[model samples]
Target: GSITHILIFASGASKVPLAGFQGTPTITFLEPGLGQSLPTANTCSVSLNLPMCSTFNDFSEGMALAIACAKTFGIA
Candidate 1:
């Protein structure tokens, strides 16, 4: 089957604001470069924290948005 979409999301769990963002962003899928096939429907665990006005709810929403963007061009 053909590829669907590509996604890249980062999480900052450190109590520090900017510092956390700079550090390792509890990645879900690593090395999912261009021309790669999309991943299956599943949830990825991460220990990163959400920024202001950004909670688990917001993160989930953002994830959806990213997926949509990827589908637009079939990044995978």
Candidate 2:
């Protein structure tokens, strides 16, 4: 099966915003060097705030989002 959803855990210091492409709430990544582009076909991406050296409590948000995403895509 193909990947339907993606969850990205980025550092709090990163400048990337926590939203989808063009503020539409659709997750995507772009990297010209890697021959990547935005608006991945049939893919939903989400990025959560996660700082380095964080505790378990800090993982709650990401985990919650992951579950929600899974349910949204009927994965859970």
Candidate 3:
């Protein structure tokens, strides 16, 4: 199993509810979306080491991107 992609999410200081996420692959892919790059950059700055990933500000868009990737990779 391998992780083909990575996605990070930011609610932009907004209230976001916590939820459980599941993936069929052995590797995990975080939420995917497009938003302010600076916030993501800041996040990465503190992240220490990350191989690959993208960031998103909106929930729906992020989920859509994640779903697309899952479909492309034959993941449920």
**Clashing residue pairs in candidate 2 (N, C-alpha, C atoms within 3 angstroms):** none
Summed over model 3, clashes come to 2
TM for every model, in the order presented, reads 0.29, 0.26, 0.23
Write one digit per residue (lDDT tens) for candidate 2, span 1-76.
1132232222212234556244333433333345321122232333432223244554445445544444434335
* Tens digit of per-residue lDDT, candidate 3, span 1-76: 1122233322111222254223221332333334221212122221212123343334335444543444433225
Instruction: List RMSD in Å for every model shown.
Output: 14.6, 14.6, 13.7
CA lDDT, candidate 3, residue 61: 56
| Most TM-score-accurate candidate | 1
Ranking by lDDT: 1, 2, 3
| Poorly placed runs, candidate 3 (over 4 Å) | 1-57, 74-76
Q: Which stretches of candidate 1 lie over 4 Å from their true place?
A: 1-53, 74-76
Put down candidate 1 lDDT per residue, 1-76, tens digits, no spaces.
1122221222212133543334343533424234323322222332322222225565455555645553433234
Which residue pairs show collisions in model 3?
32-62, 33-56
lDDT for every model? 0.35, 0.34, 0.29
